[model samples]
Target: MGFDTATTTLLRAILDEVCESISRHETGVRAHVASKILEAATKGEKTPDGLKQIGRAALSEAPTMWR
Candidate 1:
C-alpha cells in the first residue's frame, strides 16, 4: 500500500519514539518494531498514542535472545 507522505512521516516518527522508549539499539529489533508499527498504521491506527501502545505491546511480547 502506498502511504501518503504525511502518514509515512508520522509512522517513522512513531517508530523512532517507540524504539527510543524501549532503548532498543539493535538494528534487527528496531526494524521488527518498526514493521509492527507500520502494520498497525496500515490497518488504520493513526494516533501516536495508539501506535505507541501497539509498539510497546509488541516489544513486551517479543522474545528476548538473552532470556
Candidate 2:
C-alpha cells in the first residue's frame, strides 16, 4: 500500500544506466536521483531499511503541537 511498483521498476532501471556513466564519481556530492527507486522497493511506510537518505535531513522530526 505504499511503493508504486511500476514507478520503482522504471526508476531502478534508470539508476542502473546512470551508474554505468559514472563509476568513479570525481567530485560529485549527489546520489542517484532515482534513489527513490530503491527506497520504494525496500521500504513502504511500514519499513525503513531501504529508504533513500535524500531529503531526510530536511524532514520534520519535531513533535506536533497536538497535545
Query: What is the C-alpha lDDT profile of model 2 across 1-67, one tens digit per residue?
Result: 3447765565545454444434444213124334444555445422332233332321222122311
Error of 2 at 20 (Å): 1.3
Which candidate number would show the highest lDDT if scored against the true structure?
1
User: In candidate 1, how many Å is residue 30 off?
Assistant: 0.9
TM value for model 1? 0.81
User: Relative to the true structure, how large is the alpha-carbon lDDT of every model?
Assistant: 0.80, 0.38
Q: Name the runs in model 1 displaced over 4 angstroms.
A: 21-25
**Cα-based TM-score, every candidate:** 0.81, 0.32
Model 2 bad stretches (over 4 Å): 24-32, 35-67
Candidate 1: tens digits of C-alpha lDDT, residues 1-67:
8899998898888878777755555666777787899899888998989999998887776668612
* Pairs with backbone N, CA or C atoms under 3 Å apart (clashes), candidate 1: none
